[model samples]
Target: MTKAELVFIPFPGIGHLVSTVDVAKLLVDRDERLSITFLIMKAGVDSKVDRFIDSVSAACKCIRFIDLPKDEHDPNQPILLSFIESQKPHVKEEVSKLVSHSELSHDSPRLAGIVVDMFCTSMIDVAKEFGVPSYLFFTSGAAFLGLEFYIQALHDEQKVDPTEFKDSDAELVMPWLTNPLPAKLLPSFLLHKEWMPVFLGQTRRFRETKGIIVNTFEELESHAVSSFFKGNTPPVYPVGPILNLNRDGDHNPRSDRSNKYKDIIQWLDDQPQSSVVYLCFGSAGSFDMDQVKEIACALEQSGHRFLWSLRQPPPRDKMEPPTDYVNFQEVLPEGFLDRTIEIGKVIGWAPQVDVLAHPSVGGFVSHCGWNSILESIWFGVPVAAWPLHGDEQFNAFQIIIELELGVEIKMDYRKELFF
Candidate 1:
C-alpha cells in the first residue's frame, strides 16, 4: 500500500492559515504514510507564516511548503468575498503543476486530496478538476457557520436586504443555532448586495466538497455541530482543540523572542491560579492613542495584572493614530507602567497561545479572532471580548454571549477619541 499526498489550501490570513497548518500537522503526525503540502498565497507570505512553516517543516520530514502566484483577477483583493472567483483558475493551474512536477511515485505514494479553508471555497473546483477529494475546513464555530448559511437563505427569500440587515436591530433566531443572533453579528460581506453572486457561489462550493472539518470539538458545541451536519449530506469531522496539540518545548520557533518578555510569564507565575487576566488584541487589531489610553486606564483602574502588546500605530502617511497623541507609550495614563509594574507586564508582543495555556492565566481580553477564541476555549480560559472590525464582532458574540463562555465589555461602538 502507498502513502497519500495531501495538500492544504489556507485562507489568506493569520488566523485561518494558523488553524489549517495545525490540522495539517496533526494529520501528518497521526499517519506516517501521509505527506502534507501547504499552499500559501504569494502576497500572504509574511514573516509569521514563513517562520511557522519553517518550524513545521523542520519538525516533520514529509511536510512541504509552496507559494502560489498572485491571482491576476482576484475578486477579493480590496474586499473580502463570499467566494474567490478570480483566484480559482490560477490556483488550479498551480496545483496541477506542483503535482505533475513532483517526483513522488504512484506505486510509492499517490495524490490524496486538498484541504481548504471555508472562505477559500474556490479551491473546491480546483480539487474536482484535478480529480482529488477536497475537504472544507470551517475556520469558525459551527454556530457562526449555521448563521451565515441561514442569512443566505433570508437573502434568497427577499425577507431582508443584506446591506440593510447590517445596521438593523433585527434579531436573527435560527433553529440550527443555540441562541438568537443580532443582525450586527454577521460577516460584513453579507451587507453588500454586490457580494450576493460570490456568496451564493461560495455556498455552492461548500455543498460540493467531499467533507467538512470544523475547528471545534464535539464536547464544546454538540448541539450546534449536530444541527449543522444533520442538515448537510457531507461528513462533518469535529477534530479540534487542535491548537493544544503542540507541546511547549524547545520546538517553539519564537523561543528567542520569548526571553525578551520573561517578565510576563514571571508575573503570571506569581499570580494565583485563575486570578490574573491575559490581554492581547491580535496582530491586525490596532488602537489610536485615546483608545489605547482609555484601555490602559481601564486596566489600571481595574487593578488587574495585564500583559498588553502595544505596536507603533499605522504610519502617519497611512492611517494616523491621533494628532494630540504622537507616541503610544506617551498616552498611557501618566506613570501607568510604573504604577502597575507590580501587576502588569506590557510588551510589544507575547507568546499568545503559550500565555493563554499557562496555569495562571485566568481570563483573556481579546479582539475575538476565531483562532484566538478557539485557543481560549481549548485552554478553558474565559474571555472579556472587545471586538473591533470585520468578523471579530461576530466571533465575539458567538463565543462570549451566545456560548456562555465569556463576557462582552459594554462600550460605545461609534465613539472615536484623541489622546
Candidate 2:
C-alpha cells in the first residue's frame, strides 16, 4: 500500500502562501499516510517568505518545496493577474512531471490530487491531463468566494458591468446575501477593465474543480458556505481558523533582537489585561507622512497603549522598494516618537500572530487583510476595520455591517483628520 500525497501550488504572495501552507500542515497532521509537495512559483526572492519556508520544512518532513521555472517578468508591473496568467504553461509542465513521478515510483507517495490556490485556477487543466482531481484552496472566507462567483455570473449571464457603478451609490442584490451590497464595497479589480477579465475568468473556472476548500469554519460564514451547494457546484469544505501558532523559533537567534522582543513582551505584561490596542497593517500596507501625523495625533488623544507596526510608503517612481530605505522616523512627525515613547511602540516589523495572542491586546486596528481579520477573530480581539484597498472594502462590510464582529473606521486618505 502506498502513502497518499497531495501537491499544493500556492500563489507567490506571502499572504496566500502562508494560509495554504497552514492548510497543508493540517492535512498532513490529520492523516499520517498523507504528505504534501508545495510548488513555489519562482516569482522573486523574499527574505521573510524564504525564512518561513525553511522553518516549516524543518518542522515537517512530510512537506517538500519545489521551485518552478523562473521567468523574466517585470517586478514593477502594475497588473499581477497578467503575470499569473503567463505562468500557466510553466506550472502545467511542472505539475505534469510531479504527477508522473508519483505514479511511477513505488517508494513515492501515490498522487491523491492537486490542490491549487484560488489565483492559480489555470492548473485545473494540468490535473485533468494526468487524470487527477483538482481542488481550490481559498485563503479568504467563503463569503468572498460567494461574491466572486456572483460577480462572474453577472458578467457572463447578465452582461452587467461592475465598473459602471464604480462611483454610484446604488445597492446591488445577490441571492446568497440578505443585505444589499453597496457599489463601493466591491473589490477594486472590478473597477478596472484589464483586471476584471482575469478575475472573472478565475471565478468561472471554480466550477471546473472537484471541490473548494475555504479557510473558515461553518459558524463564521454559514450563509456563504451553504449557498455554494444550492446548485450543482462542487462540495465546499470549511476547515480552518488555521493559524501559525508555533513561529517563535523560526527566526535566526540574536541577542539584540531577543532584547527587543523581551522589551515589547514586558511592555504588554505591564499593561492591564485586555487594555492595550495593537495596530498593524499587512506587509504591503503603508501611509504617507501626512497620514502618519494624523494617526499620531489620534493615538495621543485616545490615551491608549498601542503597538503600531509602521513602514514607509513605497517609492513614488514605482510601487517597489528602493535598494536602501530611510528610517521610519524620517516619515513620522517631528518629536512624535519621543512623545509617544511611553504609550506606544512603533516597530518596523512585528510577530503579528504572537502579538495578537497576547492577553493584553484588547483591540486590533487592522487594514482588514483576510488573514489579519481571521487572526483577530481567533484571538477574540475586537477589530477596528480600516481597509486600504483591493478586497478589503467588502471584507470590512462583512465584518462591520453583516456579522457585527467589528467596527468600521472611516478612511479618507487625503483628508488630515484625527480619529
Candidate 3:
C-alpha cells in the first residue's frame, strides 16, 4: 500500500514558515504512512530562511522543500497578501507539475491533499483543479480564527463595514466572544484603512477551504475551537503546542551556528538559575533612539542579568538590501554599554529557543508574535508582553488579561513609562 503525500504551502515569513514546518514534522511523526512536501515561497530576503529550511531538511527524511518562482509586487501592500497574489500563477503551475509527476510514478506516495497557509487562501483554486482537498494552516491560536470568521460573517450577512472598526470606540460584540472586545485590543489591520480591505478579503476566502488546522491545543482554547464550528465553517483541528525540536542535538546546524556565540552561553552559565531576563522582539520589532535609551536606563536600574537581541530598523528604501551591521554606540544611551557591561549583554540576533530553554533564563520580553509566545510557554518562561503589530495587541490581551500567564507593557512607544 502506498503512503499518503501532503504538500504544505506556507507564507514566506519566518514565523509562519517555522509553524508550518513543525506541523509538517508533527503530521509525519504521528502517521508513519505520511510524507510531506514543504513548498517554501522564497521571501524578498532569503538567506536566513534558506539556511533554516536546509538545516531542517537535512535532519528530516520525510519532508522536502521546493522553491516556488518569485515575482515583484508593491512594497506598500501587506507583505503576506502581496506574496499570495503574486505567486498565484507560479503556485498553480508548480502544483500541477507535482501532482502530474506523482501520478506518473507508481512508486511515488499518493497525493493526499494540499495544506495552505491562512494567508494563501486563494490556493484552494489549485486544489480544486487537481481534485484534492485543501486545508488552511492557521498559525495563530483558534480564538483569532474565530474572530476573523465572525468579522467576515458580519460583513457578508449584515453588510457591516469592517472599516467601521477604524473610527468606532464601541466594544466589538460578536456572538462567539464571551466578553465584548475593546476597540484598542483589535488587530491593527482592522483599525487602518490601508490594511482593512486586504485583511477582510483574505478572511472572506477562508470559508471556501475544506478545513483549518490551528496551532493551538484543544484544552488550551476550548471555547475558541468550539466557536469555529458555526453553520458552514469547515472542520477545525486544534493540533498544536507544536514546537521546534530541542536545540541540544550535537549534529543540529542551528546549534552549530550558536558556537559563534559561545560567550553568550558562557554568560548564561555564570548567572544563577532562572535569574536572567531575555528581551527580543520579532524580526520587525525595533526601537527608535529614544526608546533604546529608556530601555538601557531601565535595565541598568533593575540590575538583573540580561540578554537582549536588538535589531536596527529596516532600510528606508524597501528595495535596498539590508546592512549587515549596526553601530550600537549610535543608538544606545550615552555610556550605556560601559555601565551595563557587567549586567546586560546586547547582541544583534539570537537563537531565541535556545536562550529561552536555558536554565538561567526566567522571563521573556516579547513582541507577542504567536510563534514566540508558544516558544516562551513551551519553555515555561513567563512573558512581559510588548506587542508591536498585527494581532499582537489581541495576543497581549489573551496572555496578560484572559489567561493570566503574562504581563502587558503598553504598546505605544512614546508612552515608554514602564520598564
lDDT per prediction?
0.69, 0.77, 0.77
lDDT of 1 by residue, 1-419 (tens): 47778878887666577778778778878888888877776443346556666666777778788776664443434334412455666677767776775545455456789888887886787888888898999887776667666766776666666678757888788865667777765665666566555665576677788888888887877887788656754677888866734633322424673465566666677888887788777756667768888888888989876777676554433212212223545757788878898878776655787788789888898878777888887789998888765567777777766678988884114222111
lDDT of 3 by residue, 60-138 (tens): 9999998887787767766556767788788787777777887898777777899989878878888888888989999
Q: Name the TM-score of candidate 1.
A: 0.85
Using TM-score as the measure, what is the rank order of every candidate, best first? 3, 2, 1
| Candidate 2 residue lDDT tens string, 72-107 | 555454335545656778777776776678778878
Q: Lowest-scoring 10 consecutive residues by lDDT in candidate 3?
A: 410-419
Clashing pairs in 2: none
Model 3, CA-based lDDT? 0.77
TM-score pick, better of 1 and 2: 2
Off by over 4 Å in 3: 74-79, 248-254, 316-324, 411-419
Q: Give the Å shift of residue 235 in candidate 1.
A: 2.9
The RMSD (Cα, Å) of candidate 3 is 3.6
Candidates 1 and 2: which is better by lDDT? 2
* TM-score (C-alpha, index-matched) for candidate 3: 0.91
Model 1, residue 352: C-alpha shift (Å) = 1.7
